[model samples]
Target: MEEVQTQRESEQETSDESAQSDQDDNQPIVSPPTQPEPSYPSERLKRAAHMLFFKRGRVPGAKAWELKAGIGKSYEKVLDQLDEELKELDLQVKKVEAGGIGEYSPEDDEADKFRYFVRLRGTLTPKEARMSGWRIDNLAALAAALSLVVSKQGKVERKELEIMIAEKAGRWRTLTLTDTFLRTGYLEEDETGMISLGWRTKAEVDLPSLMMLVAEAKPQDDDAEAPATSSMEESVPQPSEEQSTE
Candidate 1:
């Protein structure tokens, strides 16, 4: 009887150990990473900066509901914070009046909206202004593509633009340039796959200035080609009048 009782006690202990082991296996092993709540102003500033960075065109600044829907907070506060941040970078939010291009009219409010325009602090070269935040090679490719479109009266077939770029850099490079320009707001595409100047180009680039730069660049390109052409001509054996007679 003593031996049977001891055997029953051992069995009970084994059963308890198994139950504890099952419970431990069912429990979660790893805790999730902690994410601290950001402050109110920081959240607002983050939204504004995000919009400015990613938005391809002008961001509607005056509409209260627009901000509320987009950022889930007050737009006025966000704009103020954004403006302050931009000032640190020598940039500013520009206010365009109503009836202007890309204007936004809110319900029951006819106030003008602000456009993201980086106001230059002082005299800066075009290359300097653009290269501050943009890739230099991409900018050059953009200029080349834009020149082609602008020469064709503000629009060009996508294939034609690609062919022109491919001449300088291979087909793969042309494709990359096209994608980068479209993403950066320097170019836009239509339903027909037509390429043209985008909203950012319309806002920032002056047409006359661009034309002047293109005009200046043409002479340099021609000068570069002259030497190559002259060399090729000299390499070919010309049939002289004496040789023709012989």
Candidate 2:
């Protein structure tokens, strides 16, 4: 009877241990939460500076004053922060000296030409402004017009070009064929009213490879019915077995 009781006690202990192991396996695992993304103040200031410089074309002083009035920061502190960011981006601050400045104005120059009556100043050339890929319609029209001029062998009458472009592309396009070519530096008109490619267009002149290929294929098509080689080939000298033996 004691042996049976001892056996029962051992079995009970084993069952309790198995139950504890099952509970441990069923326990949920808890992990640490992820940290949120950090925002950099310097990066924000750099973006704001670039906007001021390129978009507004304002000097540092004017930009700082605008920022202070608009965003509630002192001009001096904003300027210092802007300067630090500009240094990090490898941009230099240019100071213009003028007599008694209430508001700074760009000086006039004889060489400078206005586009659509807006005066462009400081470092940004007219070509650069046009080439900045900002005007898609202008670029497309320019490309199409220049291509028509080049394909027509360096000179295309303006009216003829307009008709062709209207048929090829569509009506309601903003740029005229002449305006397009003018913008792209491809076509120019003389005083006598003859339109021709400009210097830049002349520089790019070459026989287009596609045109050359088409020209070559034309002769082959014309001669398709003719014999492959000349009849004179039979009269040409050929070494025979008898000649080799001699």
Candidate 3:
């Protein structure tokens, strides 16, 4: 009777341990956290616009938003707000100039009215335009340095030119200017610190080429410096040594 009682106690203890182990094994596992979904409509619209800008180089049309919105009634109001924001950035709705005899109306009732388009404009001088277009901030200094070299007939003290540019443009660092010059293929520095346009750089670009690029760029109607296409061709730079070698 005592042996049987001891055996029964051991079996009960084993059963409890086995039950606890099974419960532990049955517990669900937790996964790593994920990014939260966007909570606001405007944020979603902005994300959509950014995506469209990167993919197609412009904003999406009203029709596109409608399709994306999937027949949602808020599309018109959302698109209007988006247009207002885009206008602040100098982008506007692309309008068709003329409609055919049976063409669709320009009102919201017509599907064709929402066709999207964008115009890109630059707000800088010809030399400045290149820098601005490429988003290079040290452009003014590089242009000034290049101008100095060209004006002085292809030779300039690097320090003096940098100082001149700083004086003219106000408080730009030497390293930043130097980096810009190198990146843009505009100038080079020697071990003595004297600066000049590199042979390869000089071979590729000259004052005439700069003038031609300026002339070829689309200018505002009121811009006095805008040159004609014929004048632009005339401004083409003479072939450099690299060009001759080729």
Highest TM-score against the true fold, candidate: 1
Order candidates by TM-score, high to low.
1, 3, 2
RMSD of each: 17.0, 19.8, 22.2
Count clashing residue pairs in model 3.
0
Instruction: List where candidate 1 sits over 4 angstroms from the true fold.
Output: 1-89, 95-133, 221-246
Rank order (by lDDT, best first): 1, 3, 2
Least lDDT summed over 10 consecutive residues: which range in candidate 2? 110-119
Per residue, candidate 2 scores C-alpha lDDT tens digits across 75-176 of 335445665545645543433222122233455332111111011223345576578853555544555566666677767776776776665456655346
lDDT over C-alpha atoms for residue 62 of model 1: 35
Question: TM-scores for all candidates?
Answer: 0.47, 0.27, 0.29
In candidate 3, what residue range of length 10 has the lowest lDDT sum?
94-103
Stretches > 4 Å off in candidate 3: 1-133, 209-246
- Candidate that scores best on lDDT: 1
Q: Indicate whether candidate 1 or candidate 2 has the larger TM-score.
A: 1
| Residue lDDT tens for model 1, 112-207 | 243444344334577785758866665666777888888999899999999988876677798888887787667888789998887566555666
Runs of candidate 2 with Cα error greater than 4 angstroms are 1-144, 174-177, 204-246
Model 2 C-alpha lDDT versus the unseen true structure? 0.51
Identify the superior model by lDDT, candidate 1 or candidate 2. 1
User: Model 3 compared with the native: what TM-score?
Assistant: 0.29
Model 3 error, position 25 (Å): 99
